[model samples]
Each structure stands twice: as structure tokens, then as C-alpha cells.
Target: MSIDLQSKLTPLPRLYKEITLDVGGEAVHLIIRRPPRTVMAMLLSEARKAGELDEQDKPKDGGCAMRLMARMAASVLYAPDGVRPLYDRKNPEVIENLVENAEWLLDIQEDVVGALGANGAVVERIQGNSEATQT
Candidate 1:
């Protein structure tokens, strides 16, 4: 399952363009940068080379990696500068909606990743994806 998802999805780009959000009277702009593939590759390779899964109790199906990615994505999406407005003195509902959406996305990502095996490459891909949306 992990392999299939990895194959289906392309690696996220190195840097995503800046996005602007209207926060009350101010506009907040930010950019999400993709994590270096080398870093991800090294991390995964080290884990595999260590051959210490038994000691670490790492999931055989990359569950850990999936969760990490999901959480990371959720964090960004919920950030004040991300989807939700930063200082909307007039509207508080927008913030609530954004939080709800972010939570939903996080849950879905977790479920999807959990079903997939803990593949090093897939994990790396997810990290890349998270970085791509970091803004």
C-alpha cells in the first residue's frame, strides 16, 4: 500500500510559492519550502541501516512516518497565517471553520497513511509534501 501511494504521487517540489491571507486590516504572506530530499533519504537510510526496528518498535508499515506527516500538515493548515485569518476582529467563525477543516484533513491523512506500509521512500515523500505546504 505504501509503495502504491508513493508510486502514484509525485515528489513535492522544492519550494512552494508564497500565499497571502487577509487578516483583518493586514495581509499576511508566507511561503512553504520543501525539505531537502537528501535529508529525508539520509534519515530513512539510517533507520534501515540500523536494522534496529525491534529495539525501536518502529512500525513495519510506515505508520509512524505517516502520522508525523499528517500532524505536520495539520499544524501548518491551522496556523494563524495559513488558512485561518490572523486578526479578524469582526469574524471569529472563520477561525473556527478553518480549525475544523484542518482537523479533518489531519485525521484523513493519518488514516490513509496508517493503511500504507511504513516505506522509507513514502515517508520521505510525505516529508517533502509537508514542506511544500509549509507556508
Candidate 2:
């Protein structure tokens, strides 16, 4: 007897965008995808544990934000040629490579975070659903 292993749910495609960044005088073409919720959750958890905050809200661990930025860059970064992922989120070596290019990585992370947070339409609908549930 064969059981249906396929999911019955419809697939929702993730958002993607392309960009070219100048890294150390080299033109790097990247395809950035909106990070999935799991990656976002991991980012949040990593950020929370990466530093301590006092009343002034100053980060005691200076590398915390940088590490998060590296992770974000790793998560969303993809090669434009075949849409290949340049780095794996689970691999520290690949993440460290991103850290080495901190200057340009910051720019890459900016775009990645923008993609992650750019779901204005979805946010509105989700907020509406929450409001309706509370009513």
C-alpha cells in the first residue's frame, strides 16, 4: 500500500530580488531572497543571546550585531548565474567569509534585512487577522 507523501497545501513562493555590489573593486552579482520565518526566528534568537543590554540599551557584546549581519547576508545571498547559494547558514566557515568583507557585507545585509521586513501587504493582512480574532 502506498500512502500519498505529497503535501496537499498550495506552495507559496518566496520573494526574490537581484542586485550588484562592488566588493573590493570586484562586481558581485547576487540574488537575494526574502528569508523564511525559520531563518528570522533563528536571527532573533541569536541576537538575543549575543549581547546584554543595560538601561541605556547599549550592547555589551559589540560583535553581536556584526554576527547577526553576517548571518543575514549568508541566509539571503545567492549567485545570480544559477541562483546558487553562496553560503550556508549552518556553516561557520562560510559565515566567517562574510565577516571578512564587513564593509560591503553591511550593504548586503541592509538589502537582506530590507527584503525580510518588506512584507507590508502581508503585515497589513496579518494585523487585520489579529484584530478580527481579538474582536
Candidate 3:
């Protein structure tokens, strides 16, 4: 029996406008902005440069300074938390959580792009998974 996989495939769901926060809040709207490719490239380049710095010279945290900056920018755009630690040393668990979250975000991004029929860029596969399932 020849199964028509193309017919079986469904478009991924679009992201929701509002997200519920962990802290008490009614509704939070999402604003999607596509950062310029040049800006993203510059940020990645800076992160690579910062990663090369010696441990003593570098920030105490586990090479999260660049990521922290990006996260801070995102927070400012959405949540607006005034105080953010330069180095999050005590939170090893948080790093793991961030890694997981990053993976999720990447998958969502790829799905969105694929749904929109964009091509050429390579998509990274999720680690330790035999198959990709729709969420």
C-alpha cells in the first residue's frame, strides 16, 4: 500500500497572539519582529569573539554573557524586567531549562518558515529523537 505522505502532512499551527505568564497576569500579547540578517550576523560574530576570551577575563557565568544580552533584549521587548543579573552563576538548572527552551524555539521557527514555503537554509534536527511529531 502506497501512503500519500504529502496529503497526510498538515501545516503547523501559527503562534498564539497572547501567552499566559507564570506570574499572575490576565493576558500577554506577542509581537513578532524579524531582526535584520546583518544585525543577527553581527550579534553572532560578537558572541563568537566573546566566547574566545579567557575565563579570567570573561564574565564569571558559563559563557552566557552574549545569550544573556539577547535574553535581556527579548525581556525588554516583552516582559520589561528592570533588574537582570550580569552573571547567573547559581542557576545551573536555569541553563538547562534555557537550552530546552532554545531547542523548542528553533523547531517552531523552522516550522513557521517551512509553512511559509521559505527554503535554502539548513534546518537543525532535534537531538535524541527518532521522529518529529507535531505538538
Candidate 4:
């Protein structure tokens, strides 16, 4: 029997959420896109460069973790239409932007992380499973 690799290897669905923030007096709309599986490696590389990770690629500290969350939020940010990426993975400007708006990073981080399986939905589902179901 011949196997079809293309049919077996399906891409992960892109996750995103539409958000609105009050920047100054006006409400600014944006899309928070979850980093696609294809760019996970690049994002990790960026985290390392931003000092969020050590040489071993492990998290350095709490502060670094915060920075990483901010970086993730920043890189995944998109235009309100959700089609245009506001920040490019290859652009160093994202780091500068994150630094300049450090105060908002945590807020953004919560939303970004919350979007992940509704913030631990998968874990909760697995944990709620009964022993009989495990069989």
C-alpha cells in the first residue's frame, strides 16, 4: 500500500482573536495572532536574542519570562483586518517597541496566553478524565 504524505501532514489551524484597546482617547482595534507552528522556531530564536532565554534555550528568569510573553504578544500582533502583520519576525524594531511600551506588555501577554486553549482548557479536560476513560 502506498502512503500519501501530503494527506497525512495537515497544517495546524492559525489561531487569532480580535481585540480593541483604548490608546489615548481613541479605541484601536487589532488582531492578536498566535504564532503559527511554522514560525515557532523563529520565535524561539527571537526570544533567545532578546535575552528571554539562555544559551541552552531554557528560560532565564521571571523577568525573562515576562519579556518572552511580551515578545510573543508583539510578534503576533496584527492589523485590525487580521490579514496584515504589524511586526515582522525578522525586524529588530519589535524589540524596541516592546521596550518602549513595557507597561502594556503584561496586559497583552494575558490575552495572548489566554487564547491558548482558553488558558489551559486542554489540561483541564485531560485532568477531568476518569480512570475508566484512560483505558
Best TM-score goes to which candidate? 2
Sort every candidate by lDDT, greatest first: 2, 4, 1, 3
The reply for model 1, stretches above 4 Å from the true place, is 1-14, 19-30, 43-65, 70-135
For candidate 3, write residues 16-91 as lDDT tens digits.
2223333234443333323333433343344446462232223224334434333322322222221222223225
Error of 4 at 4 (Å): 27
lDDT of 1 by residue, 1-135 (tens): 696687457454334334454555576554343433354344344444544222333433444343334333322322323433122312334434443443443434433333333354454455443322211
Q: Who is ahead in lDDT, 1 or 3?
A: 1
TM-scores of all candidate predictions against the true structure: 0.27, 0.61, 0.30, 0.58
Clashes of each: 4, 0, 0, 0
For residue 26, give model 4's deviation from the true position in Å: 2.5
TM-score comparison, 1 vs 3, better candidate: 3
Residue 119's lDDT within candidate 4 is 28
Cα lDDT, model 2, residue 41: 62
Could you arrange the candidates by TM-score from highest to lowest? Answer: 2, 4, 3, 1
Question: Which whole-number lDDT from 0 to 100 does residue 27 have in model 4?
Answer: 77
Can you write out model 2's per-residue Cα lDDT over 8-88, one digit (the tens) per residue? 242322546889888789987778877666676675455455443223222334454456567667777777654435787
For all candidates in order, the CA lDDT equals 0.39, 0.57, 0.33, 0.56
Off by over 4 Å in 3: 1-25, 52-135
Lowest lDDT 10-mer window, candidate 2?
Answer: 126-135
Task: Give every collision pair in model 4.
Answer: none
